[model samples]
Target: MKSLWLSQAGLDTLDNTVALCPNCHRKMHSLNLEEDIIKLRDKVKNYNYK
Candidate 1:
């Protein structure tokens, strides 16, 4: 699995509750908004590294 990070669209929806990597945030803007949400959900569910 790949390391998961927050996207720009995700950050927008988060309403300033989270920090984002600049490059990831920029790339996220190029992706479909809906797809970003879906990817975020999947990333959360699979977030078990801790």
Candidate 2:
């Protein structure tokens, strides 16, 4: 249960949130890098469109 953006602003907004599985969520926080998150986001977007 972590905020992907690591920001308090718009925290309750659906568009600002991502529902990640526990393992993935933990990994994300551990990585703790915006670039990594953005890369993952692009990958998911590309995957979904394919």
Q: Write the per-residue lDDT of candidate 2 for residues 1-50, one digit (tens) a residue.
A: 33346453446676566678998888887877778777777775676533
Off by over 4 Å in 1: 1-19, 26-32
Extract clashing residue pairs from model 2: none
Alpha-carbon RMSD to native, per candidate: 8.0, 5.3
Candidate 2 achieves a global lDDT of: 0.67
Which ten contiguous residues of candidate 1 have the minimum total lDDT? 8-17
Name the candidate that leads on TM-score.
2
**TM-score versus the correct structure, for each prediction:** 0.37, 0.51
Q: After TM-score superposition, what is the CA distance of residue 49 in candidate 2 from its true location, in Å? A: 9.9
lDDT of all predictions, in order shown? 0.55, 0.67
What is the C-alpha lDDT profile of model 1 across 1-26, one tens digit per residue? 43333442333344233344886666
Full-model lDDT, candidate 1: 0.55
In terms of lDDT, the poorest run of 10 residues in model 2 is 1-10
